[model samples]
Target: MEKLLQGLIQFKETDFQEHRQLFEELGNSQSPHTLFIGCSDSRLVPNLITGTLPGELFVIRNIANIVPPYRNIEEYLATTSAIEYAVNILGIQHIVVCGHSNCGGCKSLYASEKEMQSIPHTRKWLELAGNVKEKITAMNIPESEMAKREWMTEQINIVEQLKHLLSYPFIKERVLNQTLTIEGWYYIIETGEVFRYNRHNSEFELVN
Candidate 1:
C-alpha cells in the first residue's frame, strides 16, 4: 500500500506533468488505433511491451486473455462487451491477442479439479480456451518436456482467441474488407522478446 501511494505521487509529479498536454487532449475523447487483448498478469504490461502511449491502445485484459465466442445472450459479458465497444463503436483497425510465457492461466488449464475448485469462476471463464488443453494432448508432448508444453499452450491459446475474435460479425466483415487486421503475439517476459504469429507459416516468428 505504501509503495503504491508513493508510485501514485511520482506519477502525478513526474509522468503526469510530462504528458500533461497529451492527457488534456485525451480528456474529452480518445481515438485509440489498436485493441490489445492481453493477460492480466502483472509482468505483462501492454503499454510497456508495445511502447504505446495512453491513447494508442484500447486494452481488454483477463485471465489467459480469453475471448469468448460472440453470443447474443443477455448478460453482463465484460470481455465481449469491451471488444464490441472497441471494434463496433470505436472503429479500431487492429486487434492484437497477446499471450506470454509462463502464463498461470495456461497452466491452470491442466490443473486438477481439486486444485481449481477454489477458483470456480476462473475455471469457468477458462472454458473458452478449454480446447487448448485438447490440442496439447493431441500433440503428444511428453510430460517431461514441461517447457515445450508451456510454449505450445501459450502460443496456441493466442491463436484460439484470435479465432474467437473472428466469430464476431462486425470484426469478420471488416477483416474481409481489409479494414481490420488481427494478430497473435507471444511475449517472453524474461527475454523481453515478442514473437508474432505468421498464419501462412503457421508459426511464431521473432519480431525483429
Candidate 2:
C-alpha cells in the first residue's frame, strides 16, 4: 500500500506532468484506434508492450482474455458491452487479442473439480475456453511436458477468442469488408517479446 501510494505520487509528479497537455486533450473525449483485449494478469501491461500512448488503445482485460460468443440478452455483459462501444461507437479500426505466457487462467482450464470449487465464478467464466483444453488433450502432449502444454494452450486460446470476436455481426461485416483488422498476440512476459499470429501461415511469428 505504501509503495503504491508513493508510485502514485511519483506518477503525478513526473509522468502526469509530462503528459499534461495530452491528458487535457483527452479530458473531454477519447478516440482510440485499437481495441486491445488482453489478460488481466498484473504482469501483462498492454501500453508497455505496445508502446502506445493513453488514447491509442482502448483495452479490455479479463481472465485468459476470453471473448464470449456474442449473445443478444439484456444483462450486465461487461466484456461484450465494452467491445460494442469500442467498435460500433468509438469506431476502432483494429482489434488485438493478446494472451501471455504462464497464464493462470489458461492453466485453470485443466484444473480438477476439487481445485476449482473455491473459485466457482472463475470456473464458470472459463467455460468459454473449455474447448482449448480439449484441443490440447487431443494432441497427446505428455503430462510431464507441462511447459509444452501450457504454451500450446495459451496460443490456442488467443486464436479461439479471435474467432469469438467475429461471431459479432458488426465485427464480421467490417472485417469482411476490410474496414477492420483483428490480430492475435502471444506475449512472453519473461523475455518481453511478442508474437503476432499470421492468418496466412496459421502460426505465431515473432514480431520483429
Candidate 3:
C-alpha cells in the first residue's frame, strides 16, 4: 500500500504534469476507442501491454477475467456493466477479451469440488470454466500435460465469453452492423509473446 501511495505521488509530480492536457481533456469526457477486459492479476497491466496511454482504452479488470453471459438480474456486475457502457454508451469500436498463461484460476478448473471448497466464491466465479472443462475432459490428453491443456482451454474460454458477449441484444445488433469488432487474445507472460486469435484461421497467431 505504501508503494502504491509513492507511485501516486510520483504520478502527480512527474507523469501527471507531463500529460496535463491529456488529463484535462479526460477530466471533461472520454472517447476511448477500445474496451480492454482483462484479469486482476498484478502482472497483467493492460495499458503497458498495449502501449496505450490514458484515455485510449477503457479497462475492466475482474478475477480470472471472466465474462458471464448477458443475463436479466436485479444486481449488477462490474464486468457486464462496463461492457454495457462501452458497447451501448461509449460506442467503443473494438472489444478485446484477453486471457493469459499460467493463471491460478484457470488451473483450478482441474480441481475436485472438495478441493475447491475453501474458496467458494472463487469456485463460483470459475464455474464459467465449465465450458472449458467439457472441452478438456473429452481430449485424449495426459494428466502430466494438464497445465499445457489448460493453456489451450484458457484461449477457448475467451471464445466462450465472446459468444456470451454477443448474446446481448445491443452488442449483437452493433456487431451485425459492423459498428464493433471483438478480438480474443492470449498473452504468454513468460515469453512476452502476445497471440491474437484469428477467427478466419481458427488459431492463435503471433500478434506482431
Candidate 4:
C-alpha cells in the first residue's frame, strides 16, 4: 500500500503533470478504442504492456481473464454489466480478451478436488474452462511439467473466452456488421511478448 502511494506521488510529480491536458480532457469522458478483458494477474498489466494511455483502453480484469457469455437474470452480475456498458453505452470499437502465461487460475485446473475445496467460488468460476480440458484431452497433450501445460491452457483459454464474448447478441450483431472486432491475445509474462491469435492460420503469431 505504501509502495502504491509512493508510485501515485511520483505519478503526480511527473506523468500527471506532463499529461495535464490529457488528464483534463479525460475528466470530461472516456473514448477508448478497445475494451481490454484481461486476467487479474498482477504480472499482466495491460496499459503498461500495450503502452496505451489512460483513456485509450477500457479494462475489465478477472480471475483467468474469463469472459462469460452475456446473460440476463434477476441478480446483478458485474462482468456482464460491464460488457453491456462497454458495448451498448460506450460503443467501443474493439474488444480484446487477453490471457497470460503461468496464470494461477489456469493452474488451478489441475488441482485435486480436495486442494480446491476451500475455493468453491473459484472452482465454479473455472467451470467456464470445462471445454478447454476436453480440447486438451482430445488432442492428448502429454502430461508434462506444470509450467508447460499451464501456458498452453492459458493461451487456449483465451480463444475459448473470446467465443464466450460473441454469445452476446450485441457483440455478435455488431461483429457481423463489421463495426466491432473481437480479439484473443496471449501475453507471455516472463518474455514481455504478446501474441495475437490469427484466425487464418489458427495460431498465435507475434504482434507485428
Candidate 2's TM-score reads 0.98
The best candidate in terms of lDDT: 2
lDDT, residue 85, model 1: 96
Candidate 4, position 21, lDDT: 97
| Model 3 weakest lDDT span, ten residues long | 139-148
> Residue 132 CA error for candidate 1 (Å)?
0.9
TM-score of 3: 0.95
lDDT of 3 by residue, 15-50 (tens): 999999999989989999999988888888899989
Q: Distance from true position, residue 71, model 2, in Å?
A: 0.6
* Number of colliding residue pairs in model 1: 0
Colliding pairs, model 1:
none
User: Which pairs of residues collide in candidate 3?
Assistant: none
Q: What does candidate 1 score on TM?
A: 0.98
Model 1 lDDT tens row, 1-208:
9999999999999999999999999999999999999999999999998899999999999999999999999889999999999998888999999999999999999999999999999999988888999999899998799899999999999999999999999999999999999999999999999999999989999999
Candidate 2, residues 1-208, lDDT tens digits: the string is: 9999999999999999999999999999999999999999999999998899999999999999999999999889999999999999999999999999999999999999999999999999999998998999999998799999999999999999999999999999999999999999999999999999999989999998
What's the lDDT for candidate 2?
A: 0.96
Better of 1 and 4 by TM-score: 1
Q: TM-scores across all candidates? A: 0.98, 0.98, 0.95, 0.95
**Alpha-carbon error at 151 in model 4, in Å?**
2.4
User: Model 1 Cα displacement at 34 (Å)?
Assistant: 0.4
State the local distance difference test value for candidate 3.
0.87
